[model samples]
Target chain A: MKIDTEKLLMIPGPTMVPAEVLNAMALPIIGHRTGEFGELLVDTTEKMKKVFQTKNDTFIITGSGTAAMDMAILNVIDKGDKVLNIVNGNFGDRFAKITLAYKGESIKLENEWGDMAEPEAVKEILDKHDDIKAVTIVHNETSTGARNPIKDIGEIVKDYDALYIVDTVSSLGGDYVDVDKFNIDICVTGSQKCLAAPPGLSAITVSEKAWEVIEKTEKKSLYLDLEEYKKKYNEKKQTPYTPAVSLIYALNVALDLVLEEGLENRFKRHEKLAKATTAGLEAMGIELFAKERARSVTVTSAYLPKGVKDKEFRGLLSKKYNVVIAGGQAHLTGKIFRIGHMGTAKEIHILATLGAIEMALKELGVKVENGVEVAEEILMG
Target chain B: MKIDTEKLLMIPGPTMVPAEVLNAMALPIIGHRTGEFGELLVDTTEKMKKVFQTKNDTFIITGSGTAAMDMAILNVIDKGDKVLNIVNGNFGDRFAKITLAYKGESIKLENEWGDMAEPEAVKEILDKHDDIKAVTIVHNETSTGARNPIKDIGEIVKDYDALYIVDTVSSLGGDYVDVDKFNIDICVTGSQKCLAAPPGLSAITVSEKAWEVIEKTEKKSLYLDLEEYKKKYNEKKQTPYTPAVSLIYALNVALDLVLEEGLENRFKRHEKLAKATTAGLEAMGIELFAKERARSVTVTSAYLPKGVKDKEFRGLLSKKYNVVIAGGQAHLTGKIFRIGHMGTAKEIHILATLGAIEMALKELGVKVENGVEVAEEILMG
Candidate 1:
C-alpha cells in the first residue's frame, strides 16, 4: 500500500535535508570547469575543514560514503600490505572488505555488533603486527548505533607506523571530531548525513602522512586515484572529473547552516536528541541495543518490542503517522529498529516519532508507556 | 568580473536542466531501504533501459560517468589480461589508462584527436591479439566532439570472444544507441549530459555475456564491483549503497521527459541543434574541428579564429552575454571551443549562444558575418 503523506526520513543517512539546502540544489546547473564552480568548490571545502576540525588537504568525491571509504583504504594499502581493521559494525566491517578486495591483508580486531572497538584491542593488534601499514576504524557506526573511542584509539595508534583512517560518515557534523588532535590521517564523511544535504557527494581529508603512503602505493583505481584529485585541486580549485554539481550546490548551503549553528551547539543538540530518544524507548520497556557509554549521538538502535513484528510496526508508523524509521541491517534484521535524529531532525521530530511508536505498539496489542511524555520531559529539561 | 545575470550552461555534460527536473530534486529525502525508494529505483531503471534501448540487466551507480567507465573495465579485465583500447580522444585515452592502472595490458589503436576510430583498425588489433578480453571505446568523445562508429566496431568485436564495452556518457539520450541490436556487452552512461538530469549519477547495462566474464574475473574494487551490484539488484530493487537519492529523483523526472519526447524525436532534435550550431560557426568564418561524417550531434567543436584569444573571447561571451561554453581540453586547449546543444537545449538556446558569440567577437574587433541569421536560416529550414 502507498503511504500518501509527507514522509519524514529517519534513516541513518540520506537524512532530512533542510528546505534551504534542498532548494539550493534546484539552482541552475553550472559548468564544473567554470570560475563560478571553482569558487563554490573552494568555499564548500574550506567550511568542511572547519567542521572536520582539520587543516589537512580536503577533497569532495562524486560518490556515496562507501566510495570515500573505498578511497581511504585503496590509496594507502598496496598488494600484500597488512591493514588493521577495528570492526564494531557494518561500516567498520566494510573497511576490512575493501582492504581485502584490493589484495591487502586485513587483520580484523572484531567486536560484537553493538559493542564499540576497544582501544586496548587495537593497540594489541598493532603491537603484534609491526608490518601493518594502515589502521581503519569507524568513528560512528551507523549500522549498530555505536560510537567508538576514536581519541583513545588515536592516542594508541599515533606511536605506530600505520596511518590512522577513520570513517566519520555519520559523526562529523553531529559529534565532536577533532581530526588533527585525534591523529586521523584520513577522515571521510558523506554529504547527506549530519551535513543535512542531498546524498551522492562525499568529502575526504588526507593528512601529510596519508599522502606519503598514497604516493608510494601503486595506484589501482583511475577514478578514485587521490593523486589526480590532489593535482586538480592544486592547479585549480576544482575536481579532477566532472563533479555532481547540483549536489555540491546543496552541500555548500548545508555547510553554511552547519557552521551557523556552531559545532559545539550542534553536537550538544545531537546529544540531547539521542538522550531523549533512548529515554523514551527505555520508558516504553524497550531495550537499547548499543552499550550505554558508547551510544551513537546520531542514530539510536533498540530492540523491537517482544510481540511486535519489525515490518508491521514500522509500516504502521510510516503510514499512520508519516514517520519513517530504519529497520535493523544484515544480522540484526527483524530484531531491532533504529531512529536517526541527525541533520535537520529536531525535538519535535523525536516527540512525533516516539508518539507514533507508542500508538503503533498499542495497536499491535503490545503494552507501551507514555513514550511521548518521557521524550518531551527530556527535550524540555 | 562576475557575470551579474542568470548564466546559461552550454558545457558538454552538465547541460541545462529543466526546472521541473531540478524541482523534483527539491523533494524531501527518503529512506533508501523503503518500499517507496524501491518503487522509484525499479521504475527509474526500467525507463533507463528504454532510453538505453536494452533489456539487459542495468544498475545505477552513485558516481560520475568515470566511475561507470572504471566499472566497465575493472569488472571484465583481470590482472595482466589483454584489452584493446580504441583511443581517439581524452575519454578513450582514459579507458586505456584505467586498464593499465588495473594491471591489464592495453593495446591502443590511437587515432587523431578530432577523428573517430576506424572499425578496420579495431579488427586488425583483435586479429593480432586473440587474448584480448574486451574492446573499449567511447561512443561519443566529449573533449573533441567526435562520434565514433560504435555499431561497426561492435560487429567486429562480437565476432571475437572479446566483450564490447561502450561509454555513451555524452550520447546515450541524444544519439541512436540500440544496445541490444548493437550487441553491446556492457554499456555505460551518466545521468547528466543528454539525459538533462543533474550530475553525479551514472547507469550501466550488463548483458548476460558480460556478466559471465565479470563473474569469473577476480574483483579488485569493492565500490565499483559489478557482481555485488548485480546481486543487490537481484535481491532488491535498490542500490548496494546509499544512492544520491535526490539526484535519482531528478533523473526519474528527467527520464519521464526523455521518454515523453520519444527517443527518435530527441535524436532528431539533437541533430538539428548540432547542424544549426555548426552552420552558424562556419558562417562566421570559423573551422569545424571534427570530420564531416564523425561530427557529434550533442556538442560541436570548432577552431578559435586567428587573432581572437580563447580566454578573452569566451570570457566576453560569459560575462557580457551570460552564456557559458567550454573551451578545448588537454592539447587542444586554447585552439578550439565547444558548444553543447544536447538535452533541454533547443533552437532558441543555439541561436542565443551563436548570437552571443557573434557579439563577443564583434566586441573583440573581429570581422564576422551575421552568424545568427545564417543559423536561423538553417534552423527554420
Candidate 2:
C-alpha cells in the first residue's frame, strides 16, 4: 500500500477508494450509448439525488468539484450579469472567478480570509446591487477549515430575485447540507472529498429556479449546456458526450455506502472526530485557524509554533515519519498545516496523523510542552 | 451488469477498464501535499508523456477529453485569435466550439462528416489564413471512423508558423502519433479510449513553442492555468488544486500495459484487426462510413440496413446479444452505428461485435449475408 516509499493519505479526499468501488469499475466496458451504461447512469443519478437531500434534478459531469463550481456560473450568470460572491477562503474566490470566466460582472463581499459570511454582509450586497443576477458562496471552505453560515445566508437571499449557488465540495457527505432548507439553486459536491471514491466527477443538484434562468442564457456553450444535457439525460441516461463510466460505477457504490451509514450518523461521526482532534491539538499548544464564526467538522487548520514554518516541517513528516499534512495555501503558506477528518477517516487515523506532526515538530526543535501527552489524553486516556 | 436495463458501452470511449488498472487505482490514499502524492504525480506525468509520444512537459487534470481540449485553447488562444480547424466528425465540431468558448475565432475547413481531412484542404486553409495562430485537427474522428492524414498534414504544418494542436483522444495509444516529427505543438488525449483506464482525466503534452505562446496569453484563469501549473509541477509534482488521484493511478497502470505491448505492435494489431472487420462488414453489404482515403483502425462506423434506425437496432443488440454499439451523434444521428475497436479490445471482441451486428440486422429483417461466415472468412482466412 505504500506507493513509492510514501505514507497513506489520512486527509480528506482523494480518500482511499474502497475495493468494492474499484472492483465495480473494473467490470467490462460498456458502450455509453448502450442500455447497460444508461441504467448505470440512471442508478447513480437516482442515488445521488437522495444524498443531495433533494427531489430536484441531479446530474454529473466528468470533471472535479471545481468544474461543478464552474458550471454553477455558466448555467446561471449571463455575460456582464452582476454576481454577489461571498468570499471566505480559496474556494469562494474560485466561485467568484468562475463567474468572471463567463464575463460576469461580480463583486466579492469581503470578509477576513477565514471568516464565514454573515447575514448582514449578504443583506447589504443584495440591498445595494439591484442588478445582481446571482448570490454565490461556499457551503464549506476546506482551505481554512471554515463552514459558512449558509442557512442564514439562504434566508437573506430568498427575499432577493437572484439565483443562490453553494459549493458543498467538502461538506456534502460529512455533514447535512439541507439544500432545500438553505434555498440553494445549485448545490455542488465531488465524490472524492467526502463520498470516498476516486476523483473525476462533480455532482450538482439544480433547482427549477436555476434551470429557468439558464434556459435564457446567451452564452455560446456546448459542453456545459445545462438545458441540453438535461434534455438528453431525460430521453436516455446517456450524456451529451462520453462520460466517466467507471467513475459513475464507483459513485453508485460509494453512495450506497454513504446512505448505509446514514446522514445523521455520518455528520455526528465527523463532528466527534473533529472535536476530539481539535481538543488534542489545543492541548499540545497548537492553536486552531481563524474563523470569525462558523466552521466545518471535516478539517481543522492549526498554526505551528511561531517561526516554525510548515514547509520544512511538513516535508520532514512525509519524508521521515510517513505522514502527510497540507501546507497553508497562498498567504498562509508555510504558516500552518491542515488536518482532514472527512470521509472514511477514524479516530485512530486522526491520532496517527497528529503523532507524526508532533514528532516532526520535536525534531525541528520548536517550542513544545510534551505535545503527544495532550493528544493522547483526548484520543486515548 | 445489466444496469437500469440499459445496454453496455462497446463504442470508442468509456471502454471496459481492466481489473489491474482498477486495482492499481484502489491503492490506499495519500495526502495531496505529502511527498507520496507528489511522487505519484511525477511518475504519472512521466508515463503520460510516453503515451502521448512527446517528451514535452505534460500535465494531468480532473476532466474528460473535452476539458483537456479546451485547456489547450485556453492556454494558447486569446480573444479574437484565428485558428484553422479541420472538422470531420462530432469531435471536430467540439474542437471548433471549444475555440469559440474562449472567444477565439475559428476558420473551419471541413470534409463530409464521415470523411477524412484531406491534406490538400489543410494546405489550402494554411495558405489562406496568415493570422491563424494555430491549426487544430482530430487524430481520429470516432463518429466518422476516419483518421486524418496526420503525417501528410504534419509535413504541411511544419512549413508554416501555425502551432499544430492534435486531439488524439481516441488514437494516441492505439495508433502512432509522432509529436516531434508531426510538428504537433499541443497533443491532448483521454484515459478511456485506447489507454483502457476509466474515464476521468485528460492529459496533454506541450512543446516549448506552445509554452511561449501560452506565456503571452493574458486571459484570466485559475484552475486551468497552464503556466502556473508547469512552474509548480516542475518544482514539485503537485497540481494547483487536488488532482484526480485514483484516475491517475489507473492511468499509470494502463500506460504500463500500453508500453508493454509496445506502441508499434499495438498500431499493427489495430491495423490488422481493422482490415478484417471492415472486410467482414463489406462482405455483408454494409457500407463503410469512413472514406477510402483515411479510415481509422480503432473504430468502425457501419451504415445500418435500409429499414433500421439507430435506437431500435442498438436496443435489439443489447436485449438479445448483450452487444453494444454507439449511435450517430449530431446531424448524423441514426445514420450510422459505431463499434469501437480500441482499449482492451482484441480480435475476438471485434469478431463478436461484428457477429452480433449481423444477428441484430437479421433480427431486424435486413437483407444481408451470414455475419459469422463473412467475419470468420476475413479473420481466419
Question: Best candidate per TM-score, number?
Answer: 1
lDDT of candidates 1 onward, in order: 0.91, 0.79
Candidate 2 residues lying further than 4 Å off, grouped into runs, are A1-8, A291-293, A307-312, A319-321, A355-381, B1-9, B218-221, B366-381
Q: Which ten residues in a row have the lowest lDDT in candidate 1 chain A?
A: A1-10
DockQ of 1: 0.66
Q: Candidate 2, residues B80-131: lDDT per residue as tens digits?
A: 9999888988788888988887788999987888778889888888888887
- The DockQ of predicted model 2 stands at 0.47
How closely does chain A match the true chain A in each prediction, as TM-score?
Answer: 0.98, 0.95
- Candidate 2 per-residue lDDT over residues A1-381, each given as its tens digit: 237424646565666666787667655555666656788888888888878888879888887787777778877776789999888788888887777877888799877776677889789879987988998898778878888888888998888889988899999889878888889989989988788877778888899898889888865445566776798799987887668777787888889988999999899888877777777777778888856356678888888788786678877877787766677767878776787788877777777877887778878887655555565555553
Model 1 chain B: ten consecutive residues of lowest lDDT: B1-10
